[model samples]
Target: MTSAALSFRYVGDSGMDETMNQQLLIDNGLPNSLAPVLSFKALDETHHVLPDVKVSTVFGSDRGNLVVPYGGSYDILRFSGPGKHDVTDVRVTVQRKTEARNPAGSHDVTTQALDSHGRAIEKFERFSAVRLINEDNFPVFVRIAYILWDQPPKGVTQQAVEVTPIGGLTSVPAHGTAVVKVSGKAAAAVARNSYGPAVSIKAYNSQ
Candidate 1:
């Protein structure tokens, strides 16, 4: 009763698409009596319901800041298996700067999973930041998290799934551009008979 989990994140401008697709396979090495369940979470960081904020399409101009769109996707698959379960053909498109600017900012993205004991079982990270002037620059930030669960046959207890910065300014100096891109894949395995429901949460700059 083994299981696999996948998670993804993307950040950029409004023109960018934030859609994701993936496949899941369950290996049937054990008995066929075990059942598998699928659960997931999709979050939108740009929109907020608390503190009274409305969703808008414009970036940075209204807030006197650089606005960036960002969010995440998470999923879990469950099934009975005596053979191999194959999950493939996964695709996700993230934000990547193609042009140049005199005072460009930085972009950072990270993914990880933790267990009920608060131990990290899986982790991945990418970061890029730059400064062109002495003035303080506030870049938009977003984060998404996911938790996995494995349900077994009767008489089994549900377990907690181990789910597993800065700068800038400017003096109008250079005429070139700075580009940033983030992309990758992550995978995790959990024992059969274990039960842990998945969860997702996020945070971003609202100012």
Candidate 2:
């Protein structure tokens, strides 16, 4: 099966909409890690990534850091056929909220590539996972660009998803617990709470 684009969906949040707010930026001006070791671009001249290391997101689910695409069902996005040219690659910008300093919020996300073709690219590339790492005291309100699921999600908007704008800062935060793999071109970076606006996530048809 092949998925076009994917977003997140929350099942049990009272007084709040089921779909979580996210600022999606998919398949637009991003690098692909599956482009072979000699061809794949380096993160930066100064920054470097380690091999076979794991980072924890402390997510509140069984799938851990992969809460976005996998949710709580399974791991890996079983893919079949299709070459490298037919894939959608993008980065998951994780914005952390820094209440004390910036009031708006800050984010600690990675500079990794997420594949939307519903297939893993040698474990370095992500298809069914959006890894988040929060090094803050308070929990972060996740607003990822999208989700690439292992299986087609049920009872969702299907067409596209709309997220509510956070007024001043709500008590309700995004889901937690994610395990990030620190390998290949994967590295960490920080972004302010300038998530701009919550964009609509058009559901991808897994053909």
Candidate 3:
């Protein structure tokens, strides 16, 4: 399955020297049918330290596995260090249908970002993409949402932004391909920013 890598960097103005303790939250708008796995890394060893990762359900009953509720939030990463720090790569993988089912069918859905040239860009914190995938014999639907936080110039204060869904609800026909482009915008602007949109795909039997 195709997954998107969210990227971020830290740049401080001159004479700005201080330690930064920050938490990055990712919201999963999809139902429990799709499970999200997040992996983080630092590209430049000298610039930043390896981040601490954690996953928890924001809503719904705890199903043992990391199952974020529909339109629920989860903490993806936490970073604490001094000076300018940059978290290079944050990869997100969505696993379809974690629980076993009778007469198992296709439950695969992935997300990726392409530049204006159609080339895959993995080094970006803010990006947009068109998701294309083939549906199995089972009918399916997709939903997406996003949250953004922009950090201040020096302090740790952050401003929250509202993210709008580019494409509304989408339906996937059985044994057919479906395509949709999703994008988001920050409510307010800040110097250092970190955020991403969440996607959810649910499968249902055709009646």
RMSD of each: 19.6, 20.4, 13.3
Q: For residues 169-192, could you state the per-residue lDDT of candidate 1 as single tens digits?
A: 213223332221111221222231
Point out the higher-scoring one by TM-score: 1 or 3: 3
Better of 2 and 3 by TM-score: 3
Question: By the lDDT metric, which is better: model 2 or model 3?
Answer: 3
- For candidate 1, give the lDDT of residue 85: 18
For candidate 3, the per-residue lDDT at 206 reads 16
Distance from true location, Cα of 153 in model 1, Å: 29
Q: Which portions of model 1 miss their true places by more than 4 Å?
A: 1-66, 69-105, 122-207
Looking at model 2, residue 179 earns an lDDT score of 31
**Candidate 1 worst ten-residue window by lDDT:** 52-61
What TM-score does each of the candidates earn? 0.19, 0.19, 0.31
**Candidate closest to the true structure, highest lDDT:** 3
Which is the winner by lDDT between candidate 1 and candidate 3? 3
Per-candidate Cα lDDT values, in order, are 0.24, 0.23, 0.35
**Order of candidate numbers by TM-score, starting with the best:** 3, 2, 1
Regions of model 2 farther than 4 Å from truth: 1-104, 111-126, 146-207
